[model samples]
Each structure stands twice: as C-alpha cells, then as structure tokens.
Target: MELKEYMNFVFPGLILKPSLYYQWDTRIHFELAKGLYQFKSEIDELNDEYFNRVYDQTTTLFNEIFSHNDELFLVTNVYKHKGDIKRNKKIKVYNHYINNKNIRFQLKEETLPYMFDDDDADEYYTSQFSLKCQKQDIRYPVLLKAICNQDFPPLRPRFNNRGISNYPDLFFINIKKNIIFYIYDDRGCEVIASDIEAIRPIYEKYNEWIDEYCREDTEQLFK
Candidate 1:
C-alpha cells in the first residue's frame, strides 16, 4: 500500500502533523505513563527490572488483545539526531534491522516543521512493515523488545542537542480491531482503541499495571 493509504488505514482522521500532545480522540483512549522514581546516586548499574516487568506485561497484553496468529502492521518513525557531531552519518538502525531480518518496508518522507524546520525532512522518514503474532515465532517479540531497549534511533527530534519529547517511536496496529499499541521507551506505553467496550477487558486485566497518574483518567473512560 502507498504511504497515504497506510496512514489513512491505521490512523484514519487523525492529523499527521506535529503536536504538543497526542492527536488521539481521548474520549475513547488512555495514555499510560511510566512511573518514575528517584534513583540512588551511588548505583553502579541501572536496574531495568521495572523495564523488564513492563515489557513482559506488555507482551502478554498484546497476545491477549490481539489474536496470536494475526498479521499486524508495525510502523516506526525514525528521527535524524542532527547536531550530534560525534556521529555524522545518516541513521541506519532500521535499515540494519531490515537487512538482518530480510523484511520489506514501505517508506514515507515527512517533516515536523515544529521540530526540524531547518533540517530536510527527507532524511527523517517512516517505515511500515508487516509483522506476525507470537504464533509466528520470535520475530514479533524480538523487534518490539529491540525498540524498547533503544536499539535504534529514538522517535524525537533534537534541538540544541537535546530530545524534545518522550513520545513513542513506534507502534503496532491491529487494523481489524482498530487498535494501536505504542511503546515509549522504558518510561511507558499506550494502547488506543476505537471501541471502549472492546478494550475494557484489556483495561481491567491490566489496570493494576497502568501508570499511576493515568489510572484515574483511564478508569473514567469506562464509566
């Protein structure tokens, strides 16, 4: 499918432009933020225990919400972290993944004038590919795990050498169910659905694991 066709199919009426917040119809959605805690200053190594727990939970949640054998569209938005003089090459994380995995990708060129108006958007692009479910074996889980582990360039623009936001870099779409799951690093993840009732089971099943700040608001959507 063409780039526009894929966007229309997965995102529908949502605007494809940059925004301070998600352009989702929040009336039927919930934003799950990762809970942050103060770290011990003397820690020698970062403990990703929480990250692993969340990732495992998400893996189970995906299997529950989505059919174990369904084909899903995995879309990733790559950012060119310009101004990083340490690395003066066009990013090729996804390219490496494609070549390593031998998968095809549909590419799209886009610009977030708000984020990178000065840089050419052609260098920053989006890739769309087909991914199978857990029944198909490890490909699906491995890719998502790699993204959460920051194996590729993040999905945010750089300004004065810093990232702009903690937005999700990639998302998996279940077109048939009209649902989208977004992974925003170890900090958190989000799941948006067209039908509240359809997602209530998932919400209830995982409510305890939902970010504390978003719990109340998420609960309100069910009422």
Candidate 2:
C-alpha cells in the first residue's frame, strides 16, 4: 500500500521533522507547533470560553491518540535546566514513549537550545512552570517525573552525540536512542514504512537504526 510521509511515522512532539497527520487529512487530525512562541499559547491559562474550546479539542485528540488499535505514538517532551551552571538542578521534565522494542534513534544537528551549554549559564530551575506530558509509557514517564520532582538518576540516554551527552547531574531518556518499543503497542497498527529517504541524513540514521533493530529482533525470534 502507498503510504504518505507524516501518517506512517512520527507523533505529536516530533514536529521539527516530517509527518502526515495533518488537521485536514482523513480520520485523525492534529496541528504542529515550533519554537517557544507557539508553545507559549498552549502553556498559558485561557479564559473560560476559549479554554473550553481548547479543552474539548484536546480531549478528543487525547481519546483518539490513546485508543487507536495498532498505531503507536512516540511523543517526547525535551526538557533542559534553566538556572546557573551548578550540578543536580531540578528541572521539570515531561516524557513520551514508543512501544517498539527494536526501534532506536540518533539525534541530528540540533540540541536543546535552552539548556545550559557552558559554565556561563545557570542550570537551576524556577517555580514558574512544571513540564508535563500524559499518555506516556508507565515506566518512562515515572522516571521523568522523578527527575522533575527529586533530581535523582543521573544518567541521560546517549546517542551519536557530538556535544555534551547530557547536563551535569540531570538525566532524561533520550528520545533519539536507548529506547524500545514492544508488540503490545502495535495492536491496530499499520507500520507502513520504517525509514524515509528524504529525511536529513542524521535523523535517517536514527530511523535506520530502529528499522535494523526491529528486523534483527524479529529474525532472532523466528530463528
């Protein structure tokens, strides 16, 4: 079957890349956002009428994304520390998960822009807001919440990383690699295609890694 770009891959938080679950498309529809400006709107408290509309729309989307039979969504929320370059900063983090045990990832050119990159920046978090994402894997999201709440577990999931693999003392499960998906996450799912050739070569590496892992795992199971 002929599959489209967005539909066969990606979930909500992976908007910097390609996807097909357009709002105008058939069956399910969702919108994408980029940069802090767009999220500023999603994060802010809204008035009653507007909040109702947003709440209803998000409620419908939540139900659809969660109840689908086979397709799995890997929604990841990237969190970086906000204050001085001190270690063990408690930053609020949210998570998303993929259920395929064989799928892996490798990050591309960019890194989290807001994270403290050098000794010059503050790594401490403020009480302004806490990050949150629902409908994630039970194990993974719990880990993230612990980080946000207690600042423990000091190992970040690393991939083909060029810069600092992680912030000092702060850890998160890398959305790029070291994650797995399982069959239970694949009930009514159609994994139309695993890799997209048009993607940036870096991200393509991640997808290829996932495809190869899945292939090898399936082979091993049957062998």
Candidate 3:
C-alpha cells in the first residue's frame, strides 16, 4: 500500500496535535505558570518515578521486539530569550533523564519567535495588566501533563514546549527504522504503532477499545 494510504488506514481521523511547544508564546506561557503553581513541587517527584518505570519497561519491550542493538535517548526542547539572560530555561532542567552519559543524540530542535504576542497592544494590556511586556517562550510542563495523562505506557514522549514551562515528565527523540518500533501511548486508550509494520495488527487488536473510549468523551476518561 502507498504510504499515505497506509497511514490513513492505520490512523484514520487521527487529530495529531503538533508538538505542544510549537509557536509557543505569552498565552501558553501564562497557562503553564498557572498549572505549575496549581500543581506544586510534588508533581516533579511523581514524574521522576513515572519516567524510571517507563524507561525500564520501554527497554524491556524494545529488547523483546527486536534482537539487534539499538540506542534510546530521552529528548526535549527548551526555548531561550535573547535578553534577560538565564543560560538555560527552567524546562530543560526537568528533563533530567537525558543527563546520563549512556544515551546518545537525546536532544532535537524546533524554533519559535521570542516574546512575540499575537494580540493587539490594547487587548494584551487589558488581558494582562501586571506585566509591561511578555518575554520568553517555554512549554514543557503543560506538554508533560498531556503526555502523562495519556494512556501510553511510560514511554518517554517527545516535547516541543520549548523551555518556557516546567513539565517534569515528557521526553522526545528520533528513531531508526531497523532498531525496534515506536510505540506511542496516545492518552489512555490509543497506542500508535510507528516504524515496525509487523506488530500493527497486534496493536490494533489490543487497542480496539480506544475507539469506543474516545467516542464516549466522559470526564472520567481523563482521570
């Protein structure tokens, strides 16, 4: 089958939200700040435990699926502003999983304009009375929440939320086709099969309930 046809057949009506941090700015920045303050420090601790468990499981799963040697790295992106000099954004710190020496090529990039606000001056001033001007664009925390709340097993998910927020959970990477497949936990009900074609049938069979679960749209689904 053609690649397009295969993707459509396998992933019909999939509404992929381009990595969360793309074009991130003031609006997303504030939301992330609110989420962090509301969620608290404990969230970071929980996310650490979550990553450890997921990484261990992913290693085992990869080994079972493929016999050849392969490397896995946790990747995340951080955005920095031109001025207001802080060497690294806060979001980069939360992605501690990649700190290890063993993992290779763990980081990737996507860019967004710094401190650019879409709203007119009057509208922005009215909406955010406190700050003279919005600066910086980081989006890690909110993206982490979205990944964690999803159903996929603790596999390290990618993030585009450049270093504007402190999401302690998400990670990102590019993979080789020959070395094991990519298994994505898309929220709670769906699992996306990437690269490895042989297991698509199995994934589809196991995750069949996701369609019904997604359709129900119950509040409980998120929890």
Which regions of candidate 1 are displaced past 4 Å? 1-3, 15-21, 26-41, 81-138, 151-168
Off by over 4 Å in 2: 1-46, 68-91, 94-223
Tell how far residue 97 is off in model 1, in angstroms: 6.0
lDDT of 1 by residue, 117-201 (tens): 5456543433222333323433446555665556224322211223322232566666567677766554566677666766778
RMSD of candidates 1 onward, in order: 6.5, 16.9, 13.9
Off by over 4 Å in 3: 1-68, 79-84, 87-95, 99-163, 166-174, 178-205, 208-223
* Candidate 2 lDDT trough over 10 residues, lowest sum: 182-191
lDDT scores in order? 0.50, 0.26, 0.30
Model 2 per-residue lDDT tens digits across residues 75-122 = 332333453243232222222233332332321112334333457445
lDDT of candidate 3 at residue 65, scale 0 to 100: 36
Report the lDDT of model 3 for residue 196: 34
Task: Give the per-residue lDDT of model 3 (tens digit) for 16-64.
Answer: 2232222111001001111122222655233444444344434433344
Please tell me which predicted candidate would have the highest lDDT against the true structure: 1
